[model samples]
Target: MKIVIISPLWERTPPRKYGGTERIVYALTEGLVKEGHDVTLFATGDSVTSAKLMSVYPRSLYTDGVSWSNAYWPSINISKAIEYSRKIKADIIHSHSQYYGYVFSPLSPIPMLHTHHGTLKSQSIGKEKQATLDYFKKANYISISRSQREPMPYLNWVGNVYNGIDVDSFYFNARKGQYLLWMGRFTPKKGSKEAIIIANKTKRKLILAGKIEKNNRNDYNFYKKEIKPLIDNKNICYVGEVSQGKKVQLYKNALCLLNTIKWDEPFGLIPMEANACGTPVISFAEGALNETIKNGHNGFLIKPNNLNGMIKSLKDIDKIDRLTCRKWVEDKFSVSRMVTDYIKVYQKFVKK
Candidate 1:
């Protein structure tokens, strides 16, 4: 099958730092290529992948500090991705971006697949409801989680294929370090501040690793006022955006990964990635965490915002074995499985 993957313009495919969608695009593109399929990645020039690269931007709009104004549509790269898809005569175009695919899908030369990544709010849907309905009527939608699909219950949902990672790349020596881990954006929705509170109450060393979206001023202020003031403790370390190598190392060395999300996350990838590295995730039982992590099995999923429950679970992290943790990921969240699921979706539409 000739597949063209349209990556999000906010970050490069296989992002250098933090980008769930970009990372998933990279995994899918590589997984398909490894399966002997013709895969083309329509992403920024900075993306590095085995698939044929069809760059729409000179560099990543996020990494290069380029605004939407810098591009032809001011900062959007959707036009370039759509143009590339048409040029390649893609048998199927799989889009990892959000509403941008709506504009291209209506006139697509072939079947198109759009995977909704973010937790869409009512306001966001209201802004693009007509366009989204029109696009989904002609194209297939892949929801990252079942919970996400409920918002637009009327859309043609092809299936739910959870985002996965290359487990081998995340292999880290679990005994290298002794500290709790928090890896995700510094936004309030992610509950980074709550992670800090739990770490403080537990008297455990907390290593915070993630990027702060400078554009969200309120989030920045919350970090500065709430999270930063507590950073005075020697046990708390705020390591900025981590590289691929650092990410694996952080997950491997840590005793466990902490995810205290407040919202219904579409699909949280950090927990799965941490599990791959032989680290159990101690997360709140909100959103996909409940579906991904089994309480007292691979990891612990406690009540949302329960700092005491989180601290208690963090203490029991030793019960989870490295081999069992790795096995859990293989059984449920391998990139191969993700690829096969998507291939099935593509076959359904393309064969028709």
Candidate 2:
């Protein structure tokens, strides 16, 4: 099948610092390519992928010093992507962004699918551009989690396919445990404060790994004032922006992964990643946490923002079978599974 993937212009297909959507896009593209599918990726020029690459933005919009022009001109680039898809005779166009591809999705000659990666919270819920949502309904809609699909009732609920990763790349070491690892953006919604409280409660050495967006200064201030003071005594470490190598090491050597997300998380990739590395995740029961973390199976999911519960839950997390954790990922959350599901979706539409 000739598949064309439309990625968000903000970052590379596999982002440098903080990009969940980009990582998923890159993983899916690579998985599809490995499965003998003809894949064409439409993303920023900086995005590196095994598939044929087409650039819409000159540089990644999420770059450190990028200007507003990088954000504004992406639509123009997307228009070109649509034209390119038609010329190349793409059999299907799968978009990861919500609004950017709506203009082209309706008029495209081939079947299209849009996967919503982020949660549709209260703020962005009712206020979503009506015309854009209308345009989205023209094509099949893939929700990353059922929690994400709650707000958009009008969209065609084709399936809820979770994002996946390369389990082998995670590098699980069965006999390593030093510090508790918190992996995610240092945003309030992600629950860094809650993680800190849990760390303090448990009296465990904690390592906070992720980037703090410069634009959200208030969130940065909260991190500085609230989360920083707890960093002393060698009990907590704040290591900003970890690489793939460091991420694997962090997960492999951790006592457990901390994910205390407050919002309706679309899908917590870190939990599965931790599980793959033989480290269990102790996260709040929200969004995909209820779906992915099986209470006491691969990881433990406690009450929402219950710091004490999360801290207490850590003791039982060890009981989860590490090999079973790896097998669970292989059975459910592997990139191969995601690619197979997407191929089924593509074939469904193309056959009709």
Candidate 3:
């Protein structure tokens, strides 16, 4: 099958650091290519991929300090991908650009598959409501988790393929390090501030690795106001955004990954990546974490914002065997499995 993957423009496919959607796009594109399918990845020019590469920008928008909320660049990215797919008479145009990409699906010359990589909130009755999804109902949609579809279950639901990672490449360590890990973008909904409180309460050394996008005023001010003062290099170390190799090292050594997310995020790659590195995750039982985390198995799940539970769980973090964590990810969230599942979704479209 010939497929064109429309990647999020904010970061390069398989991002240099701290990106999830593009990383999955890279994995999917590579997996399909390995399966002997013709794949065209529409991403930044800098994106390195085995598939045929197409791009609207020379480099990732975020690396150039472009704000994620700016829809202009992404629309251009989507247009380029759609136009190319039409020209090539592609079998499927797989989009990972959330709502922005789907809005342009009406112009698609072939079957379009859209995967939701980010969470959606209510927009009264317009933006994220049924009307919005209804506009692009012709496109087949895939959800990363069952819970992620709750906000708009009425959309043309097809399959729920969990986002996956390459488990074999991740470094696994049984001898855990002394510190805890908190990795993600600095946003109020991500609960980075809450992770700090949990680390402090548990008296564990904390390492925070993620980016603070200067273009996003609210997030930049949030880091300054809530996350900055809390980071004391000695106790709460802020290592900033980490490369893939550095992230694997951090994940393998950390006692556990702290994911105190406050929102019902669509899906998070952090927990799966952490588990693949043989490190457990202690996260709030919200969104896909409910399905990802198994208490007393790989990691413990605490009620959202429950400081005491999170602190207590952090103390018992060692009880969870590191091997079990790695095994869980290898079994359920492998990239091979994700590719197979996606093939099934695409086959359905092909039969039509």
Candidate 4:
């Protein structure tokens, strides 16, 4: 089948540093290509892919430091993608551009598949919510997790496909390291402040790795006020956004990945990446963490924001086998499995 993947313009596909949706798009694009399907990736010019590449912008808007509002570039990128889709007569257009697909789906002759990479509440609100209420039924939607669809069950959903990773990209380490790991944006909702508290209470070394956008005041203020002051080089180390190599090393060596999220995250990608590296996760049970992390098996899922439970789980982390964590990801969250599931979805729309 011929497929065109529409990606967000903020980051390159399989992003250089921090882009979960782009990474997924790249993985799925490559996975489909490897399966002998014709795949075209509609992303920034900076994006590298095994499939045919199409782009409107010379580089990613965020990486290039474009000062325009977030909505502006995506609108242009989506228009370019739609124009390309019509020219190619694509069998299916799988969109990762969030809401842009809903607006353009009516214009395309081919069937479109939209994957909701973020939470419904995060995407839909006020005018956008009303817009979604009016037009969401026209496009086929796929949820990243079952919990993500609970809020808007009335929408036309094809199925829930959990985000998957290329397991081979990660190095599995059976022997764990001394420090705890916290990876995500430095935001209050991600519970970075709470991770610091848990690490301090448990007397464990903590390594925090994530991007703090300089332009975003909320990210900068939170990092300065809640995160920077607490960082001591010896115990609490704050490593800024990591590359793929550094990320693998951090995941493979950490004692356990800490995900003390306050929000119902659509789907946390860090935990799955950690699992692929044979590392266990001790995450708060919110969003997809409950579905991803098996309690007392690969890792423990504590109640959200429960510092005591997270601290306690650190002691019992050794009981969870590192190999089991690797095995779980290989079975459930591999790129091959994700591609197969997506092909089933594509078949539903494509006339064979």
| CA lDDT, every model vs. true structure | 0.80, 0.80, 0.87, 0.87
Error of 4 at 279 (Å): 0.9
Look at candidate 4 and tell me the lDDT of residue 297: 88
How do the residues 204-249 of candidate 2 rate in per-residue lDDT, one tens digit apiece?
A: 8888998876666777787778777777747888887888888888
Q: So what's the TM-score on candidate 1? A: 0.91
Report the Cα lDDT for residue 261, model 4: 90
Give model 3's clash tally. 0
Q: Using Cα atoms with residue i matched to residue i, what is each candidate's TM-score against the true structure?
A: 0.91, 0.93, 0.96, 0.96
RMSD of 4: 1.7
TM match of model 2 to true structure? 0.93
Alpha carbon deviation, residue 223, candidate 2 (Å): 2.4
1 against 3, candidate with superior lDDT: 3
Per-residue lDDT, model 4, residue 170, is: 100
Better of 2 and 4 by TM-score: 4
Q: Which pairs clash in model 4?
A: none
